[model samples]
Each structure stands twice: as C-alpha cells, then as structure tokens.
Target chain A: MNAVIYALFIVLPYVSLVVLIGGSTYRVLRWATTPKGGGGLYLGLYRLVNRAGQRSYLSAVGHILARMLAFHTIPKNSYGRDYGTWLSVFLFHWGVFLLIAFHLHLWMPWLRVGAEAMYVMGMATGTIALGAGLFLLARRVGLRRIYGLALNALDDYVAITWVVLIIALGLAMRALAPPGLFGEAVAWATGLSSLHPEPPPAFPLFYAHVLAVELFMIYLPFSKMAHPFTFPVNPVLYGKFEDVDEVRRRVEEELGW
Target chain B: MVSVRKVTYGRGGRDILEESPMYGEWRREFEGRGSVHVRIKEETDEGTLKAIGVTEMQRIDRGASPAERKRFFASRVAEMARENRAFRHHMDACVHCGLCIDKCPEYLGTRDPTNSPVGRADLVRRIYRRLNKASDGLLGRDVDDKDLARFLEEVDLDRIWTYYYQCTECRRCSVYCPMGIDQGEITRAVRQIFVEMGMIPEFNARTIRGVYETGNNMYIKKEAAQNVLDFVLDDMRQETGRDFKAAMDAERADALLLPSSTDFFSNIGTLKGEIAIMDELGLDWTLDSRALEVANFGLFEDEAHLKYIGDNYVNAALRRGVKMVVFGECGHGWRAFKNYVAPRLEAMGVQAISITQLTAWALRKGRLRVDKKVDAVVTYHDPCNLARAGDLIEEPRFVLRSVVKELRERVHNREKTLCCGAGGGLLTDELMPLRVWAGWPSVYDSLRTGAQYMVAPCSIDKAQFPAVIQYHKAPIKFKGVSDFVYAAMYGLDVDKIA
Candidate 1:
C-alpha cells in the first residue's frame, strides 16, 4: 500500500501537469496567431513588464502573484450583485493553494518536520473548499442567470464531485483509518534505505482522492480557471498614457499652437 | 373687447363689394353705424404706383428662381450622400429610438423634429432612396433639373440648410445612440456639401477662407500673434512683477507649449495655467506664438485645408527644434494635431508627441504634483472631438484627479461622453443659440452631479459652456483643468509661472 501510494503521487501529478500545460499553450498560441485590428497599444512582453519604471517591477510581480492565488480574474466591483459566487471562488482558490503547499511537504525532504500540522490544515481548508464547490454546483444547476456565465450542470457536477471526493478521502484517511495503517504507510514511503518492509492495509479513499485531484489539475488550464493568467493582458493597462503633457505640448507646438 | 367686420356683396353680375371689412369697420365707427366712406384718392398716377409695388413684392422670390432652386436641392442631396464611410456607417447604424430627440437642444427648445440629427439624417436618406429608385425606374438617372427643383420646393430647402448647418457636430447625440452612431459625421458631410454648393454661412465661410489664406482661422497676423503674447506677458509682469516672459521660438526646449491664439488674446487664464503647471513641474517648456492656433477649423473643411493647418504645427515644431508640443484646451484642434496632424508630421519626417500623453507621462515621472486636497467637487466633460472621435479620454481624467480634491466622474464618461455642441466650426454668432441648446443636456448632466465646477480641456467647449450654463440657469462654474492647475500653483503670481 505504501509503495502504491508513492507511485500514484508521482505518476498522477506528472500526467496532469503535462495535459494542463500543453492544452493552455496551444489555446494561447492560436489566439495570438489570429488577426484582429484596433486592439490598442501593441508593445512586446518585455516592454510591458518594464513599463511603470523599474521600482514598480516587484509590485507588478506581487499583483500577478495575488491574482493567481486569489482567482482575481473577476473584479470586486463586478461581484457586487453576486457575492456568493465570488466568495465560493475565493474559498476554492485558497483551498487549492493550501492543499498544494501541504502536498509539497510530502515531496520535499526538508519539510518533513511539520508534516502533521500541514496535513491537518490542508484537510480543514479542503473541507471548506469542498463545501464551496458544492454550493457553486447547486447555483449553476438552479439559477439560470448565474449558470449562463458559468459552467453547465455536467461540468459543475464533475468539479463538485471531484473536490468532495478529495476532501472526504483526506478526512477519512486521517480520522477513520485503522490506527497504525496511515503511520506504517508514511514510514515505509519515507524510509527508503530501511530493509524492513512494513506494508500497510490498502484504503479505497486514498486512491479516490488521488484520482479526483489529478483530474482537477489536468482540467484547470483548459477550464474558465485559465482567465486568472490573462489578467495582465487587460487593454486598459496598455492604452493608459505614459506621458500626457509632453504629448500634448508636442501636438500643440507642431500645430503652431 | 372683440371687434368684428362684415362685408356684403351684391348678387348682380360682377358683385361689387358693398363695404370691405376694414372700410366698413372704420365707416361704422365714424358715421354713427349707418353711413359708409365713399372716399377715393385724387387722380394721382395710380397705374404707375401699382406697377412699382408689384415689382417690389416680386423681388423677394428673385433668389428662389428655378435654376437656383434646382442647384440648391441637387447640391444638398449630393452633399448628404458624399463619399464618406464614416457618414454612411453612422446613418446606417441609427436605431431610431428617438431618445436622442429630447437630448438635442434645438429639438427640445424649438420642438422641431427637423432639428434632430437622427431626423435630419433620415430625411436625407429617405430623399436619396426615393430619388434614386424613381430615377432608376423612369429616367435611368438619379436626379434631374426638374426633379431637383421639386424636391427643394417640397422640403423647405432654406430652413433645412439652416437647421442642419446649425449643428456644431459635437456628437451629443452619439452618446444616447444605442448603435454608437456618430451624428457628427453626418453633420460634417452635410456641411461639406453646403460648402461645395457655395451655401456656407458667411461667417463660417470667411473663417475657413481666413485659415486657408493666413494659416490661422482668426487670420491674426504673425506680428499680431507675437504682440498679443507680449501684451499678456507684460500684464502678467505688472500683476506679479517676476518677469513672466511669454517666450516664443525658444531653441532646444524639452517641450513646446501651444496655446490657442485666443488664449493669448482673450483666454489668458488658460495660458497662465499651462505656464504655471510647467513651472511647478520644473519642465523645460517653451512657447511658440507663430504656431499658436490650437483651434483647427480646417479639419471641418476639405482634406487640403486639414493638411494646410496641420503643416503649420509641424513646420513650427521642426523650426523651433523642440522635443514635444503641448496643446491648449481645444478639442478638434488637439484631435487634428494628435490624430491627423501628428501622422502627417511623422510622414513628413517630423517627430512630435501628443499633449495629453505628455501630461500623463509627467505625472508618472513625478514632475508634477497635485496637493489632491484642494477640495472642490469637479467633473470632467470629455470634448467629443477628443474623446470618442480622437481616442483621448482617460488622460484628462487622470490629470484632473491628480490635481483636484474631489473629482466626481460623470456617469457616462470617457468614450461615452456627450459633446459640448460647439464642434465642427459651429461656434459663430449665427449658431450661438443652437450651440447653447446643443450643449444643454450635457450641461444639465454636469449640474445633476452637484459638482461645484465642470472642467473641459477643450477651447471651444470652454468658450461655449459659459453660455450653456447661463441659459440653463445652472449654478456651476465651467473651467479648463489648466485654469485650476495654474491657480493652485501660481495663485496671484502669474508672472513667475509664465
């Protein structure tokens, strides 16, 4: 059971990463290649990043990081009429980030000391996220206007069920599993050089959690969630003036003001 | 008391009048209600006087001859259907919801459907469609001399001309248009056709011709332009005593300040503010009096005129060897300078920047600082020529917010802003009332915000808004952003800033 869990962790994430990265890259490239005019202010990525002076570089990076962490594609002002949808979005994103951070402890040897604390925090956040996902799914199924802008019933069902499966399995593994099964599995996985092989009992919940999380990761970049990365490409930033007075003066002087 | 008069005609062969209404009433009052006056003028050359009176009465219709009428209608229709894609698109896009009707100053004040831009465009389109179809079916031609005459007679040609030309093409109607139809384009096309037909209002014609010949619409001579600047600067010195020089053609300056010629003559406050802002920012800016006309009416005329006015700016900038040029509060002037003039300059290998863009840059660079606590509720009116038509909306707002305390934004701002109804060269005396009416809705909208002041960075709007405010009884001061900036920075010491 320990060997199998370790193998699944390594295999699932790699497959998910490959699909998400590849699909998003293709979509973005296709959009870029399409011809459309009147787009306003076309500067390369380097120039765009360098804009607002060098001192703003760190702030710009912070802004981008905040967006990714918080799923900040939808503006606060726009969510005035639909706060619940936005709140659910916020919780789900926070849960995903926390869960990923907790999973990093499993992979990184240096973070092994706080593994138990990380696991508890991750499970608690995951439970709230699962609830939020289920709420959003209900909204999508019941409310026509809200659903019009969001995922359809099938998509909502898949997303909510996946999150629920992961949270349920995570909580079950910690609370309902046999007393020594989980500890034995962890010890066997961590102790690579120890010749004493301690194989723990197989739990169906662990496999279900792994599969659901893997499916979610692979679906992320291709889903509406991809809008998070496109925040920087907003036209307002590009069209805003760098120097108003100089341009005005030059025009006046040229026009024989 | 009501007075009534009765006339009785005999039942005989010719039925000679027993008493006419006027004669009978006078006779009854004078002769005890029983007798009538049988008076006649003494033999005093009746035939000669009668012939002279008839000729005098016929003179009124002298200009409305068959040839003149045909020419007028043919030219009007041709003008309405000029080869302008912008005009065509706007006409085609109108949804005709009539929301724009009440928004029109002329339509509201006079209650005349003919004055509405949408109505005017529809009238022209209907006639064009009808004439085209009829001619195609019967005569294998669109318009003929007789058809033109009849069309003119049917559609009050003179009134249509006056009503259509009265529009400033400020694009107030475009804001309410669901399809975003720029009625200004149609108005412009109409104006162009009128010009082609030699039917332009005398004042506009003179101004257009003046700009064509003298390079400035007002036709202020080069020497006069310098003198006006000198006079203003001398006044500034007297007022503040700090050698406020209106420097012209300063070599190798970082920025070239371009105020409209009117700023030097009449609108000195705008100039003073521009100078103050530059001084506060510690910018290396200089003024050029020679190319100082920011109100480019040439854009309203043909392309040749546009090029001619644009060249003046380009030539002046190149001659001065300045790095950048700044414009005063003139919307179409800036529109021409930024959109048309700058491209022309670039094509002619002249490098110059837009004024609004330069101001935004200065703010970003910390060259200019606004206290941001000079508390006054201010809202910006985006000059139509600059905002929707010219792609300059945000810069002015950004600049205004930087300088003012409480900057209240109009609900429909930026690209969706209403026009001030003084664009497209309709700022003459004849069109003043219509101009005020055109600007009434926007003025009212600004008032609704409960703003203490409304700021527009367009010279035409600045000049016209005062009248609009007065007419609407709106208790708000209208000023340019530069005026506020100048007052804040320079205070009473205009000379030090200049």
Candidate 2:
C-alpha cells in the first residue's frame, strides 16, 4: 500500500509532469512549425490590434490578457444573454482558479495557516467549487436530452464529474476529518517537490482524492483539458495586426506564389 | 413569436426529440443536408443551377477512382491542417461547449445542431483531426487501411458539399464563442478543400468564370455596361437637375469607382447617390465599364478564385491611372478589396477606400453639404462583411445620421448584426427555404425597430431584404445608405425618397 501510494504520489507525478510538459511542448512546436496559409490566428490578432489602434505585439498581448483574465468576452453580447450558463461558468472557472492557488501551500511549508483558518478557507472555496461543478454537471446531463446529444462528448461530462468529486472529497476532509490531516500531506508535498520523497498519511479517502488528481494530470495532455496550454493558439484571442502581414508573407513564400 | 422549433432534421434522420448522438457521433453521420440530392459523377441540370455565368453543374467525380478521390481529399485536409494555424487552432480548440449552438441563425431556424456554427465546423474539424492523427502518428498509433476507409466513408463528398454550402461564413458564431473560435475560418478551409477536389458549385464556378471572361460576375459587355451607365446618368440629370457626370474608363482620374453590376439595373438610386456625393465633393472619379462590379462571388468559394477575380478590379484601377479606388455599396466586395486586395493595392501606390469612408470624410471636411435631411426614420443593417470583416461600423452610421432625420439601431446592430442570409452565395432560388429561415433573425430584428426603411450599405442586402419583407408581410421598405444620401441631396421632399 505504501509503495503504491509512494509510486502514485511521488514517482508517478514526475512522469505525469514530464508528459504534460513534453506533450504540450510538442503540440506547441507543431503549431509553430505548421505552415498556416490563410490568416487564422494572425487574422484575429490583427483585428484586435487594429481595433485597439496600437497595432503592436504588446497591444495584442495586453488585450488578450484583459479578455482572458477580466472575462471581457462573457457579457450578454458574447454568450447571447444566457446568464445562467454564464454564471455557472464564471463560478466554475474562478472556483477552480482559487482552488489551484490554495493548493500552492502544499509546496510551501512556510505558508502554513492555522487549523481553524485552513478548515474555514478550504470549506468555503471547496464548497463553492463543488457547488459550481455540480451545477455544470447537472446542466450538461439535464441538457443532454434536449441539446446535449449533438454536443456533449463523454469526456466533457467526465471532466466535470472528476473535478466535482475531487472538490467534494476535499470539503469532506475539511469538515469531518481532524484539523491537521493536510499538514502531513503538505510536508510530504514540500519534500517531494524538493527531491526528497516523503510518504503521506495512509488515509484511504485522502489517497483516493490524490489518485483522482494524478489520473487527471496524466490525462491532461491527451484530452481537451490541455486547452489552457493551447489557448494562445486561438487567433481571435491571441492574434496581432502584424500577423496579417506575416500570414500573407507565409502564404506567398510557402506556396511559392 | 416565431416558431424556432420548425427546423427539424437531426443526425441520420433521427428525430432530435427521439434520440440524438454526442457531438463526436454527430459528426460521423449527421445528414441534415436539406433536400438537395448531389450525387458524384451525376450531372445536375444547368437550368436548376440557375445562377449568373454558369452553363452547367460540373460532374463532381470527374472520373477519379475512389482511391484517388480519397487520397486527394485526405492529402488536402492533411496539407491544410499542417499549414494553416487558423485551421489548426479552430479545429483543435473546440471543447464542445455548445455555447454557439443557440446563437446560430441557421440552427435557430432549422433546429438542426449540424446547422449550428460549432456543428458545421465540427464537420471539417473531425476530418482535420483524423488527418492530423494519421500524419503525426501520435502515441505510436498507425492509421490502418480500415481506419482510412472509415474516414473516407464518413466524410462523404456529397455531405461535405451540402453542409459547407449551408453556412453563410458570417463569423457571428465567433463573436459569441468562448474560445473565440471563428467557425467561418474553418468553413472557408473546408470549402477550399472541396474546391481542390474539383467539386465546384455551379453558382461559384460560373460566376468566377464570368469575372475572368468579362471582368464582372454579370458578364455584361463593355458596350452594354457603358450604355447602362449612360442611361442611369441621364435619369440622374432629369431627376436631380444636376449634370452628374458618370465617366467610363477615363485615362487619368482622381479615383476609380466599382459598383455592383446589380446597382446598374435594380438598385440604381444608390449608384445615383454615389454620383451625387462625388459630384458635390468635386472629386474626379471614373467608373470603368470593364470593372463595373463591386460584388465578388469568388469570396464565397476559394482563395485562388478570389485572387483571380480580385486582380481584374486592381488591373482596372491601375489601367485608369487612378490614385484611389473607392468601393461602391457592396459588402463582400469591400471585404475582398480591403482584407485580400488592399495590401497589394497599397503596395502599388493606390488607396482603396469604401464609399462610406469617402462620404464620411467629405461630410467631416465640410466638402459635401446636405441642406435638408430626409424626415423618415431609418434603420441601418451592418453588412457582416463591413462590420466584422472591414470595421466600417461607425463610418456608415455617421453618414446615415448626416442624411436621415432619425437613425434607429436594430436589436443586433454593428459587430453583432445578423446576416441578411443571402451572403456566402446561398442566394440561389433552390436554397430559398434555407435563406428565408436563416433570414428570420435579421428580418425579425428589423421589424422590431419599427423604422420606415431598413437601409443597409451592401448591395446584397438591397436585393435580399425586400423578399424577406414581402414574405413576412412586414411594412418596412429596403433601401441603401446611398439611396437616402441621394434623396437628401436631390429629392424635393422626404416622401419622394420614401
């Protein structure tokens, strides 16, 4: 049991991390080297920069950041006034964001919080994330009969359900378990991140949560979950004005026109 | 309260209410391909493909063996995916969020998910993905003969031809897409792939051939074109009491104008308005009989054809020794000129400007004055090409405000404007059902505005919206921005314009 936990937690994570980094890098390289002919990504960037009037790479980047971070595209206009889905999406995204940020404490031992505070913060964020995940999953499953049959892939539902379980387990651990259970896991994480492998507590529910996350990380690069890494490839979000010129040159040169 | 559920065909004729498949399954076999039975190698009647310049619907297969056909299409898809970043990103970025499902006009009208932008894009995207996998051999996976056969079978040429044509390529879906995935780009890529397979649509091919043969889609001879211009100019003189000169192929002019061939016959008022503005501003502009078209149907087909057709206009302007080329009231023509041809034109030391920009400039500079504005309230329809593609949203509105008593904006105006459904060469009589359904959103929105006239800046809108009004029994009249501008300049009363 210890060896399995050790391998899954300490050893397998490194392998998953390698696959994530390497696989994503390969996809990115493939995108970069691919001889794109019409203005796809570049056209979007060109429009953005051209609209913003700066017409520079920095302006494109700044606009992309504002759009992505500030949720600039999510208002009634972009999402077609579907405020229900929009609210759920907003909650799910920001919930995941806060949850990811909170998990950074596992790697930094110095950033320890008091038991009561950790419990409170964990319950609050975990509940929000769990609730949002449940809402999204329910919406997907409920709409499957009406509109989902044409759009809902199995992976879509699985991704949502997987995250929901992870968050739910986390909330359970926060509310029911003794206060210091994560302290050992945090120490183990800190040690493992620093190249010294440490076995965490032998709690079955805790290990179940950890294993689910490991499976997710391992599956990330191969599935749509890798959208974050490839987000910059979307022309509308990441294109610049200069890209139009680049696209024209590429088409002319590559096609030998 | 339009019945949005009227559109019914789902995957493989399965009632969407009964049983539907996931998006992945939907792509492999969704046959919501309207009623058009396009068979490979079976020649369609020339009269049925009733479009300008087309003589016959070419046989799709052209005697290629199935293996050769499969290889040809597969290789093109592979090549496009390997080369085009926009194609790659759009194909790969779709997470099947289905956010674009409810927003599509075709989907809303037809209730077929396949008509939705994401659904339409998925048709090509799946093929692109399969091709990518075969090429990359990701995870040491090799594509076997059976896999290839399955792919070829699923991506049927007939289905591909039907679905690709059904889209308007409006990019409305992109505006609402969470990842900013422009399905239109993917549709363009897919259509390009089809064109490579030698399966040219009769309307697109014939129109393109006409442009190459006679320098315009209408195939009007230079003598006939000049005659039409002279007749319109004579009428303008009698109506306005001003000698507005319409020059043909002047050796050296301040600017060259390109108006849609349709403007010469049907929508002549807009052309007269253009002449009035040019005359008032004292700008020496010449309209060449050889390049007297602002509509480029090649934009709806393939890039090569677009360049081929676009070159004619550029050559016409250069031959005239004009310093600037101003596009008439045509949307897609402006798109082709600005996005595709403008760079090359700019490099050649000639400027390409839209009529809206030129008129707005004249108005701002106080070069052209309108003593009396038209009293009727008018609504402006932002042609998707001008608003989304060319960024001429405010310029047309500014000109409209200058000429009209009141400008009422539609519920979905500028950037988010609905297409008049005649775009992307889906203007044929055979596709009237699709057109009327897809046109519902815009027609509905226009009706909601309660304006007397729905004034669009594109010539296609001028031709398409009147039918929409007649079909719905709506009281609104369809006209152009230039038509009102002409009225503001010449008509004794606003009622005369109305």
Candidate 3:
C-alpha cells in the first residue's frame, strides 16, 4: 500500500509534470518554427498595431478575450439550439476554476477552512463538475444532432471521460468516505509540492482521485485541451485587421521608404 | 486532373450532393435530364479529366512513379503547413464544434460533408497531421516510403480538386467559427499546392493566361477596349447630349480609374455608370490603355500570378504618373486592389481607393448632385470579398441610400454576407447549375425582403446574380449600385432612361 501510495502521490506527479511542461513546449515550438506565408505571428501583430487605431486595438483585444474565454464567437442563431451544451461547458469550466481555488489550500495557510466547510465546498464543486461532464459526454455520444457535426474525434470523448472520472472519485472521497483523511491528504500535497514524497494517507479513494489527476496532466498536452495554450496564438481571431494603407506603409519602409 | 461524378436522379428525387429540399421540386419536370455531381475522384489510367481548351495553362508531370508523387505531396504540405503560422494554427485549432457547417453555401447547396469548411479543412489538415506524425516519430518507426505511398494513394487527389475548387474562398465560415478557423485560407493554400503540381481549373488558368497574353481576362485587345469605350461615350452623347470623353494614356492625371475587363465587355451598364459618376464629379481622372483592367484572376490562382498582374498595373500607373487609382465597382478586383495592390502602390506615392469610397466622399461633399431619388424598391447584396475580406461594407450602402428611395437589407448582410455563386473562378459555363444552386441562399434572402430590385456593387454580382435570379424564378431585377446612382444623377433623370 505504501509503495502504491508513493508511486501515485509522488513519482507519478513529477513524471506527469515533466511531460506536461516538455510536451507543451515541444508542441508550441513545432508550430512556431513552421514557415508560413505573409509575415509570422509578430508581423501580424505589428500590422494590427499599425492598422487598428489605438482605441480599436484595445477594443479588439477585449473582443478577442471575450471570444476566447466565453465562446463569444459562436453563432448567435445557434444559441437556442445549443444553449444546454454551452451551459454544461460553462459549468464544467467554472467547476474547474473552483477546484483550482480549492487546491491552493495545500500551499496557502489562509486558504484553509474548517473540515465541514471544506466538505460542503467539495460537494458543491464536485457535483457541478461531475454533472456537467456527464451531460457533455452524453450529448456528444447520444445526441444525433451533435453526433452529425463530423469533427468529433475519439480524443474528445476520452479527454472528457478521463476528467469526469477524476471528479467522481474526488466527490466520493470527500463526501461519502470517513472524514479523517483530509489532514493527511493535505500533508501529502504539501510534501509533494516541497519535493518530498510523503507516504500518502491510507485512503484508497484519495489515491484513486490523485492517480487519475496525474494521468490527466500527462494527457493534457497531447489533446485538443492544449487549446488553452494555442488559442491565443491563432491568427484568425487575434491577428491584425487588414488595413491597406498601413500595410503599404510597412512594405514601403522595407523598400527603403 | 479532376473529373465530375455524374449522378442521375429519378424525377422528383433528392439530389445526392446535398439532401436539398428543392431537389425534389427541381426534378419534378426532369424525365431524362440529370444533374452532374460535383463529388471528386482520383484520375485512373483509363479515364482522365475531360477539360477542354485548357492546353494554354501550365501542366506538370510530377514524376513517373506513385512513390515520387506521394513524396512530393507530403513534403509540399509539410513545408507549407510548417512555415505559415496562420496555416499551422488554423490546422491545429479546429475543435469541430460544427458551427461553420450551415454557414457554408457549398455545403448548404450540396449537403456533402466534404463541402463544409471544417470537412474541407480536414482534408488538408490530415495530410499535415500525417507528416507531423512521421517526422515527430509518434510511431515507433519513421513512416517508410511504402507507408507514405499507401497514405498518398488513400488521399483522393481528384476529390481535393473538386471540393477545393468548389469552394469560393468567401470567408463567411470564419465569421461564426468559435475558434476563428478560416477554412477558406486552407482552401486557398491547398489550391496553391495543386498549382505547384501544375493542376489548375481551366477557368482560372485560361483567365490568367489571357491576363498575361492580352492584358485582360476576356482577351480584349487595346483597340477593341478603346472602341467599346468610344461606342459607350457616343451613346451617352445621344442620350444626354453630353460628350463623355474618358482620358486614355494621359501624361498626368489626378485619378486613374481601373474597371474590370468584364465591365468593358458585358457589364456595360456599370461601365456607363462609372463614366457618368466620373463626369459628374469632374475629377481629373484618366482610364489608361495600359491599366484599363481592375480584375485580378491571380487572387483566384496562386501568389506568383497575383504579383505578376499586380505589378502590371503598378507599372502602368507609374508610366501614366497618376497620383490616385480608383477601382470601379468590382468585388474580387477591389479586394486585389485594396488589400493587395494598394499597399504596394502606396509606397510609390500613389493612393489606391475604391470607387464606392470616392462616391461616398463625393456625396458627402455635395460635389456629385442627384436630381431625384430612384423610384424602386431595392435591397443590397454585400459582396463577400468587399464586406468580409475588405472593409468596404458601409460605403456602398451610404452611396445607394442617397440615390435610391428604399434600401432593404438581406437576412445576412455586412460581415455575415453569403457569397455569390460565381466567385474564386467558379464562374465558368460548366458550373452554371452549381452556381445557381449555391446562390440560392442570397437569392432567397433577397426575395424575402419583397424588393423589386437587387442592387450589388460588384462586377461579379452583376454578371452572376441575373442568372441566379432568373434560374430561381425570383421576382427581382439585378442591377449594379452605380446603375441606380447614375439613374438618380442630375443629367440622366431616373424616369428618362431605361
């Protein structure tokens, strides 16, 4: 049991961390080095900065952020049809947001709370994540309308299912299991953060959740979930608007204007 | 080489391309006539592309062996996908939410998944992914030549030709895409790759050849173009008792007007409107013999032709010493002029502006006077290139509303505009049925407004929309925006002219 806990809580976390960082960097660099027509990312930005007036660029940034974070670019007409999917996705994302906030209790002293209060918080966020994740999975698999969209790959299903399992295991450990495992779990989290692999608490559900999270981390960079990193780099939504005069000026300067 | 797959439907049956609701109605009268399918296939040794009059275009024999063609295809895709940040990002970023499926006219018209932006983009994206997997060593062993050849064989080249050519590169799908994946850009890139292999559509290739050989897409010689201008001006003299002399090859001019060669040949109403506007404004504008054309088919082809044709006009402008270049009402021509040509010419200290912009400016300054409002119910069709690609959306409307009584709006207008069927060199005679079907959305939208006249400020729309309206049996007269503007002008009263 101790050996299993050590592998899941300590060694596996570090392995996942290394792969997450290295794989993501490699993915970014692979795309960055590819030769493209027109000016590269920076030149596109430079043109945007030149073409859009000062006010328009700032507003354009605001518009890009709305689209990236809020899925603002989804067609307005599709709202009535796909609102449930949108809502489930939002709930899942917000649940992840709260989960990240909850995890900070491992390091920050002020972030900690009473055991019962933590239990309530965990139940609330966990339920949202689990429910939303299941809804998304069901819609992707069961809904014939969405099923016809053609771009749904196998990884989409795998990625969502993996995260949902992690959420389910977490809720089970926190709300249904005996309430004595919280302190030891935090200690293990702090010890791992401090680069010391502590023997995790003798709670099977806790280890199960942690193991699932570690696997998810390793899988993150390989899937479309890597969109969080690459989305900002996309030229379509974020690139400079075309202004003939501004581009001409830049071209002229290159021609010794 | 690409060949069409012929589909014969029973009378009152669904068209196999798209499960179109009207396909049943379209076939109601068809006892023997069947539509040719736009689906793509690979060229076999026994059957080749049955394209006619395309010998003038360049053709490349990529190599004798299948392995060689496979290597060429893979390496070219990798090179292009790697170098272009937009291409790389767009290729990687599609989440396949399917938001862009219904937004595409080709997909809506054909109901073929391959015609959708995401589906078309994936055809090219899969090649990029295959090359990425091989080079990145995702597989334990590097992808060998045999595997690459097998992969290449699986990739139907004729399908790539049919679908990619079928796309108009309108960029409408990019507007509603959650990730901003411009699949039109991918289509253009794929088309450019095919051009590298010396595979080009006969329509685009022949038009490009004409531009090089005769300085225009329609092969209008200098004398022929000059004579057309003379005849139009002479008609203008008889109608309005106004001597309209368009300066040609002038030593120096304040503005140089570049109308599409189509305007000189077929779109005489638009050409005459341009003459009236320029005459009324009384600007020091010249229509030079060297730079008489504004249409750039290179935009439909690859970058080399784009540069060649772009430089041709720049050289003409330099030779004539014009300070400003005015692009007459044309869609892709204005895109090439505003986005591509204008910037390069700006460095040479010449200003490139659209005729719509000039008209808007003239209207604002009260330089060009209107006698009376046009007594017609009109709705505007926003050309995709002008609205989505270029930012000339409001100028045309502002000019039109000043002359016309009521300017009705289509269901999808401005940046969200649907493409006219005959764009990106899909304007050939053979694609007439496909063009008419693809144009159903805009034509249907116009009919919903109950407008008598469909006004569009584009040469392509002028040439294409009339056919679409006639085929759809829609009760709308297709006219250029400037045609109404000319009718509402002081000299040519709206009630006096045809």
Q: Candidate 3, clashing residue pairs?
A: A34-B82, A34-B83, A35-B82, A35-B83, A35-B84, A36-B83, A36-B84, B17-B110, B18-B110, B18-B111
Worst 10 residues of 3 chain A by lDDT: A42-51
lDDT of 2 by residue, B237-298 (tens): 77777787778888789788888888777887877788788777667889888788887776
Error of 1 at A205 (Å): 62
Model 2 regions lying over 4 Å from their true place: A38-59, A70-75, A78-80, A240-257, B1-61, B65-71, B133-136, B492-498
Deviation in Å, model 2, residue B68 alpha carbon: 4.8
The DockQ-based order of candidates, best leading, equals: 3, 2, 1
> What fraction of the true interface does each of the listed models get right, in terms of native contacts kept?
0.00, 0.29, 0.36
In model 3, what is the error at residue B364, expressed in angstroms? 2.0
Q: List the residue pairs that clash in candidate 2.
A: A35-B83, A36-B83, A36-B84, A41-A235, A45-A239, A45-A240, A46-A240, A46-A241, B7-B110
Q: Alpha carbon lDDT of residue B242, candidate 1?
A: 58
Best by TM-score: 2
Instruction: Report every candidate's CA lDDT.
Output: 0.55, 0.69, 0.70
Name the weakest run of 10 consecutive residues (lDDT summed) in model 3 chain B.
B1-10
Give the higher-lDDT candidate: 1 or 3: 3
Question: Residue-wise lDDT of candidate 1 within A130-209, one digit each (tens)?
Answer: 78877766665654332111213243356556666677677776666665554555554455324344342466665566
Top candidate (DockQ): 3
Tell me the tens digit of each residue's lDDT in model 2 across A1-257.
Answer: 36777788889878878877887787777766765465532321223212312256677677666655655555636213566777777777888888889888787768758867866777787787778788888877766454533576666777788889888877766566655677788877877788987787667777777777877776776667766666566655554433333433432332233
